[model samples]
Target: MDLNKKIRVFVVDDSMVFRNFLIKSIGQSPRFEVIGHAINAFDAERQIPQLKPDVVTLDIEMPGMTGPDFLRKFLPKYPVPVILVSSLNLRVFDALEVGAVDFVRKPDVKDEITSKQFVSTLLPKLLIASNSRVRMPRGTVSSAPATTMEARQLQTPTPRTMEHFAGENKIVAIGASTGGTEAILDVVRNFPANMPGVVITQHMPAGFTAMYAERLNKILKMEVREAKNGDKVRQGLMLIAPGGYQMRLVKRGTEYFVSCTIEEKVNGHAPSVDVLFNSVAQNARDQAIGVILTGMGSDGAAGLLRMRKNGAFTIGQDKETCVVYGMPMEAYKIGAVCQQAPLLTIPSIIYRQLGLLTK
Candidate 1:
């Protein structure tokens, strides 16, 4: 790949500093060029078609028509790759579920140090966005709010095979984003309630997490609930990070308890996989297993790699089973993953790893 070919990009953001900083950072990369820049969705609406950029960096919260609203309209007409640059808010994940290609966490670029730091991370996500293909519009997708059967039905499943686990009080930490609902449902349905205690981070809103948990609880044998501070980790139970907060595990002696904290978002996601995985790596070490499921971007790669390095087993859903293979691909490329398997085979893999597989 030639870094000097100038991969074209369009920037849609309300912040002048961010727009300037992003363009400057991309320009430094021998690989990217900013062809167009817009202040908000309305401006983007007029500029995007004319520029026809290969990649678009969008800010979800903009004045005069938000990014999501713009996406609701412009995406069907001109299907181009979009990478959302969002604040430290869970709402970023909501944009992803609506079909944004990837995301980058935006830091306040008031100083040169922060500006330089932002560029270092932003360029990579943009390059990845440039290389990837956006989902083609089949027709008018639903405008209904992110819940209801209509919303759930629109989710597409990523194909995967499973591996058997040895079965223990295996702590399984799973992460997902764009198309995680169905994947989590599939895995939980296959798992027996007596299966290991599981913790999950699905990019979702606060209200949505409760509903999702209730829905999953009705179908899967294991008990599912949104994580609250000081909750215990026990077999046959699953804890999901509530929207807008980061959930981690704190061990009081030998028992584990859920700890929730309000922190600046990392990787544009609250309840970020990075925070959960890092905490698990430090406290659980080899005793726990980390799994990164379907999602866009490289949010979990670093943390999962830390888990593997600390001797904990790590799993990444393979490309075939990922709606956007970005997260797993980044983890796999850096040797952070112990195994890469499809979704269906994941349960059995868990069983085998936990020594539950019997002849």
Candidate 2:
């Protein structure tokens, strides 16, 4: 835990080629050292005790035991920060729910662009995971609810229609990173299928946003999809800004839509929350609701402040419910947040603001 010491990393994957690639790529960085490599969970379980790595990069589809299974078994006994290296699939979220810190989409080794993208994404995540406090799986924490409000709300189907809010052209803009996958899900899933249109920017690498959106669509009543260039922003639909691209809200005539473009990293993140929030400030103004969730940086703080100055309602997740408390804390400090609440209460709070429910 010495601040001066290089972060020691353990790489776990089934492919020998990938293991070597990771070792070589990580070796090039002065900040990280690949202390050990494992082909599967069994190998990792044995070597982890001796190697005592500062961080672990895991593969989800390994033979014998999958990544999620390993986390359920290992974290309780030997709590260590785990970063999942996965394909564009739902398994990554499953791993996060079980206690992995974050994930990077697996790069296609044959493609040069993808390989470079992998390195750009992996390096920062390793650093973040190294400094993070790993928590026990939600299932193990008996004091808190195992299932989020979204899941329970879905069970008793509410047939609320969007007809009443037809005149309110409001949009919700959300931003998150670090532990945001589950945090955002907890908020979005509770939203009624007929709620106002929503847009999100989650700090994720290329090829993962589509899958993440698809996963949310399956559980939530609302239609969720990865934002496309010139996609119309409409009620009951949630557009996730595609990873590696910047999404901005633009008004055409009386209607609003998003313009997705590849741009330089803003505040050290592409698909940056700042980019999305600033756009909302310019376009939606007082008609928008901005929410800053758990993350690791100040990317959205200034943008949230801009939105508030422009008269948009803003909310920040309370530190007690946040996995990192960095982004929301920064927003709160800068007077960007109009209200702060725990994760579970966010959806209801949004509904109250929109007049969907009596406060």
Candidate 3:
């Protein structure tokens, strides 16, 4: 971003108090300029195109026209990044599917601590959003594995399809932030249910990870859930690191389990991808495949490089397919990634590298 030009932001919320709070909070930032505010989506639509703000902070529960509805009708005509500020709920994902760049959950109990916490997260997201790619109705997440295979491969793997799948003791570790929710789902949904157990760290606030895990479980063939302290890393399961915790890979007597604990935030994120990837680098070593997906910042770059140096294959999402092109770009710059591929092709790339897919 040009230093001379401050990031222009537009605020949209139903509650006057909340709207004023946003305006006041954002106004304090020298990097951000609150160009305008709207009490509803209808007003926002009218003002946004004319105002042409760089970013939009929206509340999903707006009266008359909801956030998702507005995104559906508005984004195509006037492309702009939108950050949803919503209470803990699944509807925010609906907004995300429609093209919202990111979301900040409303403080459960409005207080000094909560407000500061909210801003600390929101400001960085706003910075990320300012540089993010706003996909119109975002690409449809591929459910099929990226390989030439029959449906049986995903459900019940045959001898040929299951080649190298058993006794491999390999695992895939994925990390993302920003546009990660759908991206993570996109990659994992393609894996066979028998694929080696995978772990993921997506930067999210506390309380949302469980919901995200539950949502992923419903959409995926493999079992998905938020990681608990002693959750085993086994075949056919995808464990998402719970928010507000640092999850590490622990090897105990030929079995792998996760250790999740409340810890100091790393790289400005509680569930830092670096922390997880570093643990994988140390524990899983050469038996891991590290994937850094679409996200902002350099959280996973160092850890990914560590994984690569330790003989683990690492992949970064290519710039063309990334939302912010920050994390993967940083990783690629540092030679941490063995290869960079488009988002949709990454699953196949992993499988191919593991000799699980045909050329």
State residue 218's C-alpha deviation in candidate 2, in Å. 0.4
lDDT of 1 by residue, 187-257 (tens): 66756656777999987655667767776787777799998999999887999999879999778888888
Count clashing pairs, candidate 2. 0
How high is the CA lDDT of each candidate model?
0.77, 0.88, 0.88
Winner by TM-score: 3
TM per candidate comes to 0.59, 0.88, 0.91
Model 3 segments more than 4 A misplaced: 108-110, 139-168
Encode model 3's per-residue lDDT on 183-300: one tens digit a residue. Answer: 8877877677777889999999888899999998989878999999999999889999999999999999888999999999999888999999999999999999999999988999
Weakest ten-residue segment in model 1 by summed lDDT: 156-165
RMSD of 1: 8.3
- Which residues of candidate 2, in runs, are more than 4 Å off? 108-117, 141-162
Candidate 3: clashing pairs of residues: none
Better of 2 and 3 by TM-score: 3
